[model samples]
Target: MRSSRSWRLVVEAFPLLILCIGCGPASTASPTAKPATTASTAAAVASVEPDVPVAQPEPIAEPVDSPSAVIEPVAPQPVFRPDDPREPQDDAQLAELGIRVYESRRLKLYTDIDSDAARTLPGYVDQLYDALEAYFGPLPPDRNGTDFQMTGYLLKDERLFREAGLIPLDLPPINHGRHRANEFWMREQLYDYYRRHLLFHEVTHCFMTFVPDTQTPVWYLEGMAEHFGTHRIQADGRLSFGVMPTSPDEAAGWGRVTLIREAFADGHPRTLADVFALQPADFLMNDAYGWSWSACHFLATHPRYRERFEQLGRDGRGPRFIRRLTELFEPDGRDLATEWALYVVNLQYGYDCGRAAIDFQRGSTLTAETPARTVMIEPTRGWQSTQVLLEQGQEYTITATGEITLADEPKPWVSGPRGISIRYAEGHPLGQLLACLRAEEATAAETMLRILPIGEGRTFAAPITGTLYLRINDSWSELADNRGEFSVTITRAD
Candidate 1:
């Protein structure tokens, strides 16, 4: 059964960003079925203001003066031509349009685009291949030792795209790309900014077919594709990601993020537990795709959950998705929904994953000095925790006091106590140490437990004479101005 991960606590002064975009399904279309809605190019472009960093892919080997500076083009190479006669008679009309066939070791391209666009096709496909391979592992070969080669049909315009008959004409123009089996089809953009973005997104669907049919949930199937689909190609062709927006001007994914934020504010945010229960066919809402992508982004790139997320994929079973979630998130008695709510509300482009993991330690020991010691919790300190020794039947008091100053919002006091008292496991020191060393590194769920709330602070007597691990947390106020300090002082009760 899906756990009711509730979110009733109100966070005062949670000022969120204002942006807008309509939600849609993935761009991939099944020829006979309704087109899967993808993030619309029009919607993506509309959401980005002149100041926001436009989401785009870096050209392979192009040098940059600055991140915002336009990428210089590489010297033109010849367009692709097939080594042998091209089969697939459906593309006959494209051949008449002076189409060129570019064949690389791993991909085959069919497009009417000129040499400039055609030359870059190989590099783009190669970049997507490397990125997808890194995350999902290498692709399996067919009966023939030759690697499975994916074919891309890049139509010159919507008219040509429609005439090609790859996607049904009934689908809306917003559907820019579609992946059918091992083939990918996409229409060319006039002023292409997210051209590579759309290309990678569709191709990712083709690559996903290799995963064992473990009845993979629709959210994961589409979410992971969109997650990698948003990957930024580096100058040297290596993939670079996990870049959270440092400034307002640098924000990307305004459309998807805006959609999710609005939903969350409306109290209809898609929860992980909810996503797990859904099948792919049923997850047809546009926000579902967007939330799925964000969820995948949170899990795949976030330092704390990366490994476990990969395991979930490798395990490739639907049940494992929920099982891992229960084990990793709810174990600490911290509701996943509450944590996710805070994450999406403040989410912007270029989120920093590594920094977040360090700031929010999952299973680490905190050093606490005796009697009256004050431990500071800062915005940069995500969820660092510590352990204090207490005698059975002895009472200890904990209080948190601080105020966070945002850019344009009121300075709210770092609300209520954010600490959890963990009962010490009874075991031999050597045995425990060995087990700790040998055991899978503990995740947040395995180590942390429910906070014993007593007033705005916790004043409780120890039930056993042992060390009590106190986890210091916040309301997930990850705003840039989340830069404040809360001091925790622990003392024995009279």
Candidate 2:
């Protein structure tokens, strides 16, 4: 059994999304193969045509002198004060400050100070709900209408926001927003971008109450809220999702993504297993919010992994769920760390999982009698795989040479075009990311053309005798020249 607790994402001034408490690899190339050449054989692809610039949500700075913006490493102090008396309800006094309550089919907005930004509160809430419903479906049945209808107090400025005493005075100022029970609070001035982001994030906290006895992991809970918090409304009134920017240079969370990726590069990356194993207390102790959100984004948008993630939602806590996780996500419960590292490093904003999906094919068969066999081939377009027959207990080495011309413009997944990889026949978490990368299961190519400095040269002993798949992939492909050109030589040792 797990304990219940609340979750939140706190930055200097950003509104933290808090949740109530309750609970809770690998190699390079093959052996016997020649050492991989790390030298650059090809120049990087020219820049691609720029895409229509998507506006990042404007950042709001909190007023100084307020200590609420500072967060310590200790356990999160309860910012939610439901037992505190409600704000004074004097119609005349409130009218003086332009306070008003707007009602909609699914929301009740309370604005402390009425203004153009305040008026649009309902519309934004509607957009958030529309996007959330489209992705997760209608709110869980157990949630009452009041649960969704938040009592939002839009303070006029940081001074007023701090004075309200909605949150602990010692905590950092939550510039974006804050939520307690069904009540939401934020400072509405300058613009609504930060305010909207806060509202969406806190509202998601409101929806969490509906989940049945299951004590959902804080990573998933906050990740899902961050997934929706960055929602963008289109001109047609449709809600677009998973729009977190690609680089920290692009937006706030985007920078966090880069930090996580860099941390991985530094050999300290947090794996999916680490995040999944977190209890309520552990989540607040570390700065995993950005990584958690990225994981959720990967699961939600990646068509290959989306359904599986949905299935995971139905699972409850305890050993049974752990068994399910091991059965579906981590077959051996070991390679998960290595496989997840490969997946997150290659992730990019608007990543198209369909393009880089794994495709196994019976490539030109190689006969391993004595002399080594070699062949020159190009990776198949997309992820439709090419394969080769291997025998159990036999050791093999694979070497790749040459590079493909990637597009000269910004593309999804990783930048430019991707290179190639080799893997054992297992499950595809998302089309491109492998479920398992056991030495016996699968391995990457020694070399491939790509931006990131992933390892080269794949060497491993065949765990089973059968047809293993070699996949041609990149972050994604768009232009005609997105394919990589390479030569692979396969050798068998006695």
Candidate 3:
């Protein structure tokens, strides 16, 4: 009877296991013919626009640093605490930083990530919780209204992290092929960082909680943080700020930025303020973080945009308000989607950051076995083709240029934008991801977007390009954010 049951199980699952494999005369995974073009032809209706500018004051730098400013943030005094080769940190001192943020921000710093998993680290955890209460007021982990939990996570190292469980960005040596653990940062590092920079980029996510927390594009969610997250304290009260794309995580945004900069890089650069008025929503075919960074950069630096951001910061996060905000400015750029598509094509042709002669093969799907140092194109606009046909073996990359939308559809299971569905490989683990993307002593109901679905869909162009990606996986079935859709373009850079 036991032998018979074993045979039956194998028979029940084989064919469904792998839809396709290895490229050949015609690998099972090969996309069915619809049309294969290096890039989809741009419809004239979505006219591309010119680059705008960030309107910052002539001496804006002086004011922020001055003592009389409203924020009056004290900068950190500089010191050189060289990294100890002997005490080599297995990973970036990220976990330590996580621990600190927990304590300082929430005042529940006792619960340490490295501490025993069975119970919470009271001191670390308490501080983290306390800080949350103070900043935007109370927020129970379970519910805040938004379907998704705008949260973050930390992990120790590659091996232990993968062993613990995570969705690998890619296979073999791909940066994303395997799972990279994102967990909590220890306490000291978190405060030290905040004191110097007078920044805790994480708090920006809190901004979402306060407002409708509407479907914020990836740019606003991460780009704003990247812009402000870099400040560090000098013991003497001077602040040192790192470029927004400081780390591998943040550096990834640059791939997209380079293209836009190049577009207006020559002759006269566009004003940052006018660029902000372009409204990312209007541009659906570019990398999200890059676009958002540029968008935020305009607000942070452009003289006019500086005033705009200051004004908006005073207002709530709502479509009506944002729409009203746009009315106050002039169009600096246009046709964001086309500009984005062209940028990816350029890199795919030859923008070696230090890898292959041409590492990225542009198309809906990528063919490299290596990991992407940067996400070349993260789509934000939703599908607007009026038709989308996807297959398991077929992969695609979406640059998050704006808020993308998706058609209504049921998926195998995944988190993020609604109407998204995709299947992940068998080895992928969903439980660990849920645990990792959280505050150290996170309550049971934290709405962190930890669930990785094989695929997700939304009208937003960036979020719903296709299921083929380097990292992230399923267990994300219910968390799909498929509320709206956006116009999208598919590419075949090869």
Candidate 4:
């Protein structure tokens, strides 16, 4: 079952910035107040203003920059034959035209567009934002809301894309970055999605200002946008998205799948307090997007999301969101985990009581069986510091002992197996460590694992919510020195 993970509650190391280009927005231009589902590109442009920091990927490999984290470009250079499908349009000279469109529509959006395809931005904004606000709710008046704008650096040359680690589109994947006044690269096709999702997502950042500090869970914010990504223009012209996701389509990107996978993997509820404690760094953009999106989706898309959102809105944040939902299922209403279990069941199965816009998935419990074996670890060699890989939605414990070791004194040796590791502070990064923990290992567990803790197992919860993709450090501690042979177990955490 898809646990109810709240975006506001999760520790968002950094915001994700992705624009799939095809689907992910709500727009209605050509006329009228134009359903929130639609807006005049000119109106949307006028409505958009300012900017903010925001949002992923590799095959789960490769390095990515978060709001503050940056990695050098990957190898196996990428080449786009001047005429790739994502080539920028030739409309650079029309920034003023875009300005004119913004002026005409009264929309609050970016005024400086640098693409060769300029004048059309107004129309795009109108239709794009109109559609977006319709599905997610109106953009907030300021940063408190989700309204946002950015200086789009349309990439026409391969050098531009390469600079952002966007080349080798085949080598895992890398997403660009954005902040209030900083720069972000975008493919021509990306504009299509950005003008829709990323743009609105930034706008959502604005809406967040209105969110009561107490009610702002990391899960709701991202999940709502991600959940809305599946929206489509219905025959009646109304926006709609009701039906369990089926493969990949234009309306939703592969991002949808990633969200579900994370929610199922991250299988429980996390507190906003814990999330707030994380370093304010953009480490895992993909995880942020997937995790936040799932967190929100698990709440709003659920049968009880509306009630919870309403209660929290009425009460103005605090414990209402959690308390209200807990009351909905249990008598005492304390088992937040059970509430999450309920959410997983609802999402995994989805609901269609006949309203509109209801989309969820099957809970992981339905698919996952109990682990045959479970135990804690101090993993070593071809492994990482924290490699907690249990079936999604299952529980397990981590145990370790002082354990025995074979000492080989002050002799310089590099053959056989020498457990290598790097230690980092609280604000340190797993991505950075993963890049360094390589000595003839591949599988994540093998490439970077830690072992021989000074004492017992590092007791912790399985990462069963948000983006489950994580890497541990190549660190370890012996009774005294650094060279020794040790063994630990990774069985079920029963």
- The predictions' CA RMSDs to the true structure, in order, are 17.4, 17.2, 27.2, 23.4
CA lDDT, every model vs. true structure: 0.49, 0.45, 0.29, 0.33
Off by over 4 Å in 2: 1-92, 98-103, 111-114, 134-148, 156-177, 187-194, 244-254, 279-286, 314-339, 359-365, 368-385, 389-438, 441-494
- Ranked by lDDT, the better of candidates 3 and 4 is 4
How do the residues 211-298 of candidate 2 rate in per-residue lDDT, one tens digit apiece? 3323455677767776776666678876565575533322322234444555655766665646655444443322355566767776
Per-residue lDDT tens digits for candidate 4, residues 1-494, read 11234323332322222222111223222211221322232222111113222210113355665867677666643221111112233244343234211321423222334434445543443554565455444432332332344334433453544444433343222123131222223333332433444443443433343232323444444454455544444466454532334323333223443334444456633332332332222123334344444445544544545556445444434444445433443331222233333233233212221221212211122113543322222223212223334343444433333332223345432211122223231233211111112112122122212222222334344333211111222212211222333333344545
Q: How many backbone clashes does candidate 3 have?
A: 162
- Clashes (backbone N, CA, C under 3 Å), per candidate, total 12, 48, 162, 96
lDDT assessment of candidate 2: 0.45
Compose the digit string of candidate 1's lDDT tens values, residues 1-494. 12334311111111122111112333233222323333444532212111111112234665766979887667754222112222464445666756667877657887778777677766667767876778777654433455656787777765654565544443334435555555666766532324555566667766665443333555666676667666444678665543332432222222455556567657776655555444443333466666777878887876667787787677544345455544555443233443454466546444455444433322222234335555655544333443445555666776666543322335343333432222121111100110001012323232222234322366776654444433223323333444555566666666
TM-score quality measure for candidate 2: 0.58
Of candidates 3 and 1, the better by lDDT: 1
- Say which prediction, candidate 1 or candidate 2, comes out ahead on TM-score: 2
User: TM-score for model 1?
Assistant: 0.57
User: Which regions of candidate 3 deviate over 4 angstroms?
Assistant: 1-102, 107-152, 158-203, 235-287, 330-494
lDDT of each residue in 1-494, candidate 3, tens digit only: 11334333322321111000110010111122211111111310122112111112233234466567676455643322112112112233434333322322232222224444313223322333344344333432212232212222232344443442322333222111111111112111222222212113433333333322223333444455445544433477443332333322222212333434444435323332233333433323333334445556544544334555545444423343444344433231222222223223222211222211112222233335421222322122211121222223334333222232222354322233222333332234321111111112223232122333322221122222323222222221221432322223333222
The positional error of residue 355 in candidate 2, measured at the CA in angstroms, is 2.6
